[model samples]
Target: MSTTRSRYTQTRSSTISDDQIADLIYKLQQLIPDDQIHTTTLHHHKALNTKVLEETCNYVRRLQREVEDLSQRLSELLQSMDNNSPEAAIIRTLLMSP
Candidate 1:
């Protein structure tokens, strides 16, 4: 019975894998000075990676929500149209006319 439309938008953006981020972090660690590199730096990289992953997951969830909302709306519309309705009769006549 809910008619509120979903505001979610589908994004076709590609996501990077955690393994790839790990590889990049490993490579970055090798580039930094041994003395400058510490646990904090690794932690920061991990935090940033987690943030990106969460964003991607949220984006997917939003898209799914939008799809589900649209599907529900379509189902509601179809349910409202019985065979005796004018629109339904028109649709039937159109199909049979051809």
Candidate 2:
């Protein structure tokens, strides 16, 4: 029947989406910096998953911005200093050492 076929298709689509969400959440868990997302009781809730994914994405974006700002500042500092100066040498050495 048409109705039965439609229902089966819908169920298949839903299962696929659920599997995709589970994969995303697993990757996110691995990327999380801390052991804080306990999530033992709330993983089945769609709203909670959305919230967690949003927060994680925002946090990573913020970190990216911070790294960019710091790199720019460091570049400026190096550019403003005399290339042969002791401070520049020390900075270069530190960077190379670690």
Candidate 3:
């Protein structure tokens, strides 16, 4: 009787975990654009997840580079302005704040 109860508990727990995993994977898939999951299998979902993650990483890196370039240009432009100007002082103060 104990063995049977243990098996039943384990099976139920596993099923719930599987459901949770599927739900998370579905959410992740929805976040990535152009990700199409055609099959209802774990392998296909895993593959799509990997692809989505790689694409997201690459996109984030590209955006970081763009932000860095823009920040550098802004700093240079600010430096070229007259240091005594009210506008430059305001901008420099804003940039220094968290």
Candidate 4:
């Protein structure tokens, strides 16, 4: 007889929750109307959706630029610290250590 064991110990759960689905459904309902729910209206909806998505992407890009600027400023400030300062010495030691 042979004994078998599983190597995997954990299971992954879905990233999307019920609340997210409900919210998406609500947004879709708000975007679509019963009278305008025909195939002919799809193009109009698609254009509006594209516009909104583009705006969101632009906003995200702006935020990313701001974050990058702040990070660069922080790095410059850290680099400006005196090498003999306690904080700078600790940082240098940590960087040199394995």
Candidate 5:
């Protein structure tokens, strides 16, 4: 298993002045139609959902690996018990019981 770190960082600095922001907004209002904005929002939401699904799959796979390891260890412990031991015979009986 391997992990990767994102190198891209969110910008904390805002160089745009208030006047520039107002100008940009005014231009955006003129350029982007109201109907298209809804489509844009939907696209962003789908992208977010994809990321969530990917993360969930990774977690499930890791848990499955841990469960398999625990099962193998349990099997080994049972096999190490002598067949003549009372407790071991009881365990075998329990396992074989219908």
Candidate 6:
């Protein structure tokens, strides 16, 4: 399996334990102004969501750039191949035959 797939599987299988949840709830309860908790939590979640989206976009762009670089290198290598060389001639013949 791919490294990314394995990591995702591992993360998916993991869950927050009940003790953690309880601790979180206890902490939340300690905060002042209970009426503003909901709004504060929503804002915090929104900020996290935005950060995740930005990171995902950056990763995608990096992958795209890597793919483009690989494509350019492959084109350069192909261009460097001697047309008169037996291997190149054979490859051209095989490609044309198909």
In model 2, what lDDT does residue 92 have? 67
lDDT of 5 by residue, 60-91 (tens): 55665565555455456566777588876676
Candidate 4 has which clashing residue pairs, if any? none
Kindly list the per-residue Cα lDDT of model 4 for residues 1-98, writing each as its tens digit. 00000101111122334466456655764665656556888778767765775566566556655655554554455568885798866755653477
lDDT minimum window of 10 residues, candidate 2: 1-10
TM-score of 4: 0.45
Q: Please give the distance, in angstroms, between residue 80's alpha carbon in candidate 1 and its true position after superposition.
A: 2.0
Tens digit per residue, CA lDDT, model 6, 1-97: 1332343344445544547645655555455354554875966765665566556556655665565555455445446788588876664554347
- RMSD, candidate 2, Å: 19.5
- Per residue, candidate 2 scores C-alpha lDDT tens digits across 1-98 of 23333433444454334356567767875664444545664454545666788687667556655655555565667778898999988876764573
**Candidate 6 pairs with clashing backbones:** none
**Among these predicted structures, which one has the highest lDDT?**
3
Q: Whose TM-score is greatest here?
A: 3
Q: Order of candidates by lDDT, top first?
A: 3, 2, 1, 6, 4, 5
lDDT of each: 0.54, 0.59, 0.60, 0.53, 0.50, 0.53
At residue 68, candidate 4 shows an lDDT of: 53
Which regions of candidate 1 deviate over 4 angstroms? 1-40, 82-98
TM-score of each: 0.42, 0.50, 0.54, 0.45, 0.45, 0.46
Output the TM-score of candidate 5.
0.45
Please, what's the RMSD in Å of model 3?
Answer: 20.3
lDDT of 3 by residue, 1-98 (tens): 23333433454454334355456556876675554544556566677677876576566556655655656566666767887898877876766577
User: What's the alpha carbon RMSD for model 5?
Assistant: 18.3
